[model samples]
Target chain A: MSTTVDRPLRADARRNREKVLDAARGAFAETGLHAQIEDIARRAGVGVGTVYRHFPTKDALVAALAEAHFAHLADIVEAGARREGDAWEVFAATILDSAAPTAGDAALCEIIAGHPQAIEAAALGQERLKAATGALMGAAQRAGQMRDDATVQDVQAIMCGFGQVAAAQRAGAQMDWQRYLTIALDGLRAR
Target chain B: MSTTVDRPLRADARRNREKVLDAARGAFAETGLHAQIEDIARRAGVGVGTVYRHFPTKDALVAALAEAHFAHLADIVEAGARREGDAWEVFAATILDSAAPTAGDAALCEIIAGHPQAIEAAALGQERLKAATGALMGAAQRAGQMRDDATVQDVQAIMCGFGQVAAAQRAGAQMDWQRYLTIALDGLRAR
Candidate 1:
């Protein structure tokens, strides 16, 4: 939905919007949601007014960021869902692939988790991400590839917890995210 | 060592020490490490001097609390080590049992994670806990019960991550810790 939003903007306006999104992505990746909007505008080489006019609220900008990631995740999920092999294998790949991007950036993870104190535009991103994950997980459960007891929320919380672990790992905590992810995947299998 | 710290003290002095520990535990459990020394003393019905005399710093008090947890965890690990059956089973029991306690409390998990900005006393507790866990895991690995690639730190990180999932679940996230723990255990098993 976000990617298709178009109202026939001026050429300069479109360029400015693209610049703001790029700057915001880099800024959020570096310092998370706490990166000041002024810094993002400066990095974009645009006036703060230009940035604000493009996205009226910080959350709206965050939603834009989230929109990008979730869209990528959705693409991955759709691919996984389309796979012909074992449902569990497909689901496992989906989980690992879906989380890989957000786990690499604390800011991205923060935006994805929808920290109640931050990211006002989280609802749409949350919904989209939820649907993608659900589709994959639901397929697995229906095929008896995953534990019947497993819920989409369970996968989400595990993903979020790992995101924190990624941040901790960056902070010098020794951990291997992939190894742990494999373990989580194994755990999701039907008993 | 902390539990048996020997010193001559008047009965009221002993009472004050116990009271301070109680109040500090409650405060930290409720509000995390940010709970103030002044508040702890007031809650304990003791003078600030009494609290200060017992714990010269918040880190010291936090260390004392951490000491209790590690001691409990050590007991679990030692019990697992003493078990006669499969090493992995004993070790898994120990991991889940140990995490079950602190996972129920937010402050305890924060203390365990050794947040860079908080809980400075965590190092000693971490060291003790690590040593105990290492002994159990090392035995399991030596006996070919667990995957050789697994390390004590890996297990610790997973356990801490689960502590987070527990918190998230409390906040209404859907997840089954035991099920996930099973996956981690399976991952640790020898192929």
Candidate 2:
């Protein structure tokens, strides 16, 4: 019985790990960085012991949350940048899509805004973002699909604005956030 | 002696009220809406008694905070919208100016986001904002400065995005926030 318990527990631990990440992401999104890990465990349908085993501390969990989002963002950017679509279109679409309803986006953003460690991780994430945005901008400029004066920094700014719109949408405070992005995109397109 | 004392106290009360608002705005900007009222009083070089006496409650103080900002925003938008500058340019500039470093912008934002009461008060504020933004869009559309398809809803979305950029700037989390607003503005402008 003891041997059987140990073997099954390993599988349970793996399941709990994924569960913990999912719950932590949801809790952090709803309540920001200060969300209680205990609540996260409950949301994950796991015991506190399982949560602790999967993520020893909140910071570790936060790191994981941000890391997951960053990886996803990087993949999206890479894929989009390689596509034949207009560079700006692909870049803007990827950003808008990443910010769209996703499991961990809120959690990722909360961590970036409120946690030092997460911000540092986001710095690395930003580097990748910069590269992807740059590639898009360069392509668009070459294609005469974007203005020559635009910079990657400009793309970064748009992302910041996008975040604002996204936040308002989440809070149920506004419904036009996406429309504003479209308006701004119109301004950004080749003139 | 009693009359004399009352007169001086009334004058003192007025002075304290001004001080509390100033300090609260600064504190809110720095620490978000959670900045303590007592700290605000202390920063204003006044007693907590004076703060409570002048504003009665934190909700009252927060309402005053939102009201003041909304009024100011309305004024800027109205003034800018009425000006001879191109519609799109004025719109972009007005939104950008709001994001610039100011003494109380952050605090004002904090009071609105940190407290539910302040957010409720924001409806009136939003109405004012809509009016101002609508004026700008209307004029821009008339002048062929913006796309005919644009609506006030589009401006509202940009405003929400601008708010996020402003908050991130206040938190020092975003450096490119304003630039993105400019890029987005490009999309809103006429072809």
Candidate 3:
């Protein structure tokens, strides 16, 4: 076995790994899952071999990136849940934050919608986000911020709709997802 | 020139034409714009040559089908506008009825969204639908049923979103578009 495989990653190696992930994230955010690994390597100032060694495959890299983003979203939603304010504001704000970034990300939105059967790890990440969303929704309903009948499924449908709207906006339809989401959120509010 | 081109369509010829259009409508509604002309002819129990005679190309057939649907939607919106009821109810009902069918028809939704630059006739049909929708929305706003801040653009965005939700629902995700639209419409209502 190569000594490089046996030894722990040194500081420079770790730095290179982080750089590659960062480059991949930026590339994917800009160009979606179709972002080329060679381009990502060039952006990271690393060799294509280095990227392949770390990721092994494109799906692996994509799944890793998707998991991280989903986890980040869950973190954001959970943080919002703990914030001191109207429950609905926390809810709406979190959604707006996600929608704005995701509007340009076709790959991430596909993962969110669970279309074409996402990878197991990415699907797990989505499940985590869904659970976190459910908690926030339940908290809002209990606080009388959201209507009693509102379900996480309804929120999922709305989020998927808003994601497409964001895409439509990107595709030259001039419309505000934030305003439309607010309207839906208002509908979710308890009387 | 072929004699058939100059002669008035006998009853049988007219019936065949209607059959081809009907078959095209059903196939497109079921399988979208990708619905094959041969499949449409087979479904109509007519020969493929018959389909070709009536519709010179798939785009022409698809465009005609989209125009007819748009015209039908425009009529529905206009009829709703004339109906005796609360303006908001009229508006909401019209949206729900349109969404239910459109949710299943992806190609029509794409045309409605003006994606890939829809045919001129399909675009014209959409314009008529928008005018009718505008009339209903204006009536609702004037009657103090909907918010003054709400614009026809908002309605279009919502319709686009709902049409997507309907599509999503068809693709194995169980969702109640009516309930969600109710929430969205509630958000549209004047305070």
Instruction: State the TM-score for model 2.
Output: 0.83
In order, what lDDT does every prediction score? 0.74, 0.68, 0.76
TM-score versus the correct structure, for each prediction: 0.76, 0.83, 0.79
Give the number of colliding residue pairs in candidate 2. Answer: 7
Per-residue lDDT tens digits of candidate 3, residues B1-191? 67665768888889999999988888877776678888999999999999998888888887788777777777777787777788888889887776666667766755554343453666776777778888888999999989898888888777767766766666667676687677877888887
Computed on C-alphas against the true complex, the DockQ of each candidate is 0.34, 0.49, 0.46
Clashes of each: 0, 7, 0
Best candidate, DockQ: 2
The Cα RMSD of model 2 versus the native structure comes to 5.6
- Answer with 2 or 3, whichever has the higher TM-score: 2
Q: Put down candidate 3 lDDT per residue, A1-191, tens digits, no spaces.
A: 66565767888888998999999988877776668999999999999999998888988888888778777777777776677777788888877776666666766754554343443576766677778788788878889889898888888778766766765666668788788888877778887
Docking class of 1: acceptable
Q: What is the TM-score of chain A in candidate 3?
A: 0.80
Order of models, best lDDT first = 3, 1, 2
> Which 10-residue window in model 2 chain B sums to the lowest lDDT?
B107-116
Greater lDDT among 1 and 2 belongs to: 1
- Per-residue lDDT of A60-178 in model 1, one digit per residue for the tens? 88877876776777677767777778777788887788778878776876544435434334455566667877877888899987878777776775675576566667667777777
Give the native contact fraction of candidate 2: 0.74
Candidate 2 residues A1-98, lDDT tens each? Answer: 46554544577678888889888878888877778988998999988887888777778788877776776776677777888865667767865665
Give the poorly placed runs of model 2, Cα more than 4 Å off.
A1-12, A47-53, A101-105, A109-116, A122-125, B1-9, B98-104, B109-119, B173-178
